[model samples]
Target: MAETNKPTATKGVLSIAMIKKLIGAVVGIILGVYIAGIGVPEGLTTKAMWGMAVFICAIVWWIAEVFPDYVTALLMCSAWAVFDIVPFGTAFGGFSNATIWLLIGAFGMAAAVGKCGLLTRISLYLMNLFPLTFKGQTLALMVTGTLMTPLIPSGSAKIAVLAPFAAAVSDSMGYKKKTQGAGGIFAAMFLSLGCIHPLFLSGSFMCYSVVGLLPKDIQSQVTWTSWFINALPWGITVLVLGYLAILFLYKPEEEKRLASTMIKDQRAALGPMSKNEKYVSVVLVLTLLIWMTEVLHGINATIIAIAALAALLGYNVIDRNTFKSGIAWDAIMFIGCIFAVSGVFSALKITGWIGKVLGPHVAPLLAGNIYLFLAVLCIVIYLVRFVLASQLAVITIFTLLLTPLALKEGISPWIMGFTSFVAINVWILMYQNAQYLVAFFGAAGGEMVNHRQMIKLCVAYMIISIIGLLVSIPFWKLTGLIQ
Candidate 1:
């Protein structure tokens, strides 16, 4: 490759940013034309160009790490609107979606919980329980996380809930935690993805709410009871299985934190739970109860969560700044932007088009063969984890497109829903999900294993989990064990 020192050509109007935008436009035009030639989306060159442009830019922003993911998302939305990809209102209107509000409100509740030291207190209480054996301690942690995930749907929330606590446990036990980094990572990963557990219902708030937005017939088959029943067994099974797998696979080289890293030294600092902690605990339980019985209570979990915050604020337990500090705004914007752009995908029915393409190839394999279809779909969704880095992204895109196709293929919608749920969390390779790697690496994602090793590990995980699911599925069907 050759290098140049002089400035590159600018736009005809002559400005650096204008030149980049022109380049983006030109690249979009070329790619759109090529896609039209190859048959992904047909006709309407203008719309295709704009859609592909936002898509391209979004990917580039992530690869470049030029800005936060949410920034990239908002820019994608702006690009679509500015380029007239869809009606301006259509592009921006989804920002006001009730789905988005629930996510935002959930973020607020997570923040409030954190500021009140409720998560630490809760996590410590969980960690400190059970016998001193590794088996007992691990089981306790798994139970604590399983119960917590649905209420805090964000994977990041799980990380916040578990990472520090895990680190603290490692410290308290005097275990150096080097060899068992994978175990630590695995424990945290469960917190991130285990929200679909049976505690709430047939589905997670996000999954159910997204699915609920479907037509009533589809919605009826995927109620809370049904989804929770179908999913929780596998969800709980996978988490426990994965946890035990890590424990059996590795142990710390030497105990660094065991029996030495506790607050046992500082008698004055170590005290019992205070009144504020009790108050937040009550608020959390009430919020969860209200959330689970949304239909009967006629009030959403979000309002209850917000009310809890207001109550905290009223009593000056957590002032505005503390509360504000608790919120993870990146999650809100990132999820919201992705949801809004999903409107464009909805507007263009892009997933529908992809469905048309895959339908023929997939139908024969799935026809009259629920086992083959379910197994293949799970692997495909699992392999898809390699391509998509974020669990939420995988769930959103996969469920949006695959659920409808699965239904159309004569596979039970409920079965497909369960398969999709399993796929999102079953990824075992280090790189496939950031939440898995974050604890191991000490950030969201800062490390990598070679592609070959990653693929092999993922394949092993995919094969094992699929086999387990297959053996268990018959039982699930016979006893009507799952939702």
Candidate 2:
């Protein structure tokens, strides 16, 4: 009788999924038709109408999860080409962007690090040092994640590398899934990963991509070191606040004399480091050194990443098969497609059209009040992430729309770009991105914590982030970034 019911249940789930997809399709088509039918304003090209239609449809599909994000990205590009919104060559041009190659290399290195057992060794070693209590274990995981940020540009990759060890540590400490202890552990991991992005240019692709969107004069002034200096204080503050918030909201039951033996035993099992580990370590360190000294060396960060990948492949740390299967191709493709579409916007001047339409109406209200403008802008961007799935997409779209207005209102483009990058990352729920989802569910197949608990913790962190931005305004002004 149980066996007979299994197939029926499976069919029920499939039917629901099919219905959702169909509804999403109908909604997307209707939205496209409605927007395309609207008349274009004076000084806007006919192509802008088609571009706007495709953009709306893509957003609808993305929010509805009508298709996988990469598939939606491909469909967007196809629409651009077929409708002559841009030339065929231009629509698919993201494949040639250097950032895509950088992502490939970064992801390849992560795979190599994971395959050689180094990631496990590092995580276990950290947890072992503070294994006596839940708070200590949470701090250890947070520190490990923070340390890995500069080396791993992808937050999802960092989570993928450390999540398994986090699960192991939680289980060994007798903290079962859905308990406060488990909730605290997962919360620490999630918040740390989210907060680390602003600290360094290499921390995430979103950081440098924002820099790329800046005007040429401003872009030339920004460097890896400058970005680190500008954002370090806020990033550290968020991490500290996140740690405290977790402890306050989810107080784990006291476990006196909890054994640290599991981590030690696992560390002992690994024995000594192998040749592959040593080689990957050396390459990672050298790559980081080069990335830090870009001012003196004058090599682009993307090129440095590619060279590191080549060294990994050259030394046999990662072979073709491992490299092919290991990289996050979906993420890379989505980024590339977004970048390509951005280029099309630049070429056709659609971004300029956006500024022309919205700038006059909004710029006058905030002309003399920089602080109020910054606060309102940041909050609006933060709230907008609820409907958007991709951080990169948010940064690309809103930055294009708002940067001109920011400049016209006497605010520095640098401040506008930096604040937008940070705001888009402030998510209150797991459905916002894949990294959030991974951290919400443990590496092993079970829910790590209750949804309400996670939401409360995220809300606290967002409040802290906003306060941090408000306090930093004077410092930014003194530093000549906002005159």
Candidate 3:
């Protein structure tokens, strides 16, 4: 329940954004109606045409923010069913996906952890370990965020938890809003919190969505440990290069040491861990242990996550209100719809048609050289991020279109999928990264860091992200992801 700084439409007000959304909604409806009425195009079925119509509208609305993403998702599935583009079961199949439940379970656990302040105490304790200087605090924030990454499921949730502490530290150091010191602190926090998501399966909901989009056989092969192992090379590159990049890009106005009590006071404010904290800790740790050891136990992560959530609730670590409020139901709805949309896309043959249309031009690039293919793929997604406000949408669409070509090139589709996921996570522009924006304007508050400095960090992110994927090519080849 951390407050987000996303802009809202005021009643009876006609903001430029609202005007754009209205125009987008009307255009979306018109485009959908026109596309649907044009009859089946060559190489596409009537169902595919209908699916395209729904998709066009959904994409427009999604980019326009015409509705909550979950609401738009619901509309997509309902339209599919109403138009008979797919069966009701197929249109809504994402709800039946175990990935959806896993996300739910993860959110539940995150809620309990946040609600009980365990994450806060841990973060402050870690930050307090470093000397109070700008560089020290920056490193401390990065380490804290990275260590906490695997434990918390949501990147935004982690930002919400870390922003206040970062702000307090900045203030203590006399780094005013928009100053270099304040900007550095917040930028480091955002980078550390957001950049490493793809390194862990449960690190972001987007990771689960990526896995959900994979072929069933591949999905079966991916586990928490396996995902970590596969992404380690890229993750290490990003972590090392990204941290160095931050230090190089931003400098503090002064090198003043932090007041020792600033971080210590925050840590001490929590006093002793409460019973809820202890119980939630135990459940989360045990769940993570199970996830990491999935190869040995042969248990699915979803089951472990569900069990962990159940334990939290069963042991009263999460109260009824906490369960209802803590879990990100909107994320669940949106993620489920992503799965459903992917299913509908396949069922209607849209995915295959998309692959066919784009395949010839793209296949040549992917056919002979894995490194060349990855570079091209990363650049494409990075450019696509310019117009597409939704990172998940970009990841899903590119993965769907190029996966076939990757497979044809004797490459594992996972390389394509993971590469696209990393590429799309960048935010060179302010609007490109929603979670970063929310953290900057929401948790970190607009006063801490200005857009100029963050954009510099974002440019660094764009370069680092692409390099991370390209450098991982060797390791991926060693792992048989590339032949």
**Best candidate according to TM-score:** 2
C-alpha lDDT (0 to 100) for residue 199 of candidate 2: 78
| TM-scores of all candidate predictions against the true structure | 0.69, 0.75, 0.69
Provide the clashing-pair count of each candidate structure: 16, 0, 0
lDDT of 1 at 295: 56
Give the lDDT of residue 316 in candidate 1: 72
- Write one digit per residue (lDDT tens) for candidate 3, span 1-483: 224423343433557768888998999999988998987766898778878788778878877779966798799889899988899999899899886676667667766776787867765666568876778888888887888788666565456446666776676567877888888888788887888889998788788889888888888989989899999988888888988887778787667775667667776777999998888778877876776555566787788778888888898878899787666566566667766766776677665565465556666787666777777877777776654445776677777777777777777778767887888876655446656654664433355776667878877887888788888888888898877
What is the C-alpha lDDT profile of model 1 across 1-483, one tens digit per residue?
A: 124423344233357555665565566456545644554445335575457556655655554444555676677778788878877766666567664455444445555555556655554555546654455566666666666665544444344335445554444444443435334434434443442342345225446545643546867666556656555555555565556564554444543322423433332254666787778677757766666556565775556655765776786777778655555555455555655655676676654454455556655665556667668877777665543434554556546555665567544555555456557664354334433432333222222122232233344445546655676576666645333
- In candidate 2 the C-alpha lDDT for residue 478 amounts to 73
lDDT for position 77 in model 3: 87
Task: Indicate the TM-score of model 1.
Answer: 0.69
Give the poorly placed runs of model 3, Cα more than 4 Å off: 1-18, 37-41, 133-138, 144-236, 244-258, 366-373, 381-460, 469-483
Best-fitting candidate, measured by lDDT? Answer: 3
Per-residue CA lDDT of model 2 for 337-381, tens digit only, reads: 766766676666765565465446545655767767767767776
Candidate 1 wrong stretches, greater than 4 Å: 1-40, 43-45, 92-94, 131-137, 147-203, 206-237, 248-257, 260-268, 368-370, 382-413, 424-465, 476-483
Stretches of candidate 2 off by over 4 Å are: 1-4, 131-134, 144-233, 245-258, 367-371, 383-418, 426-462, 473-483
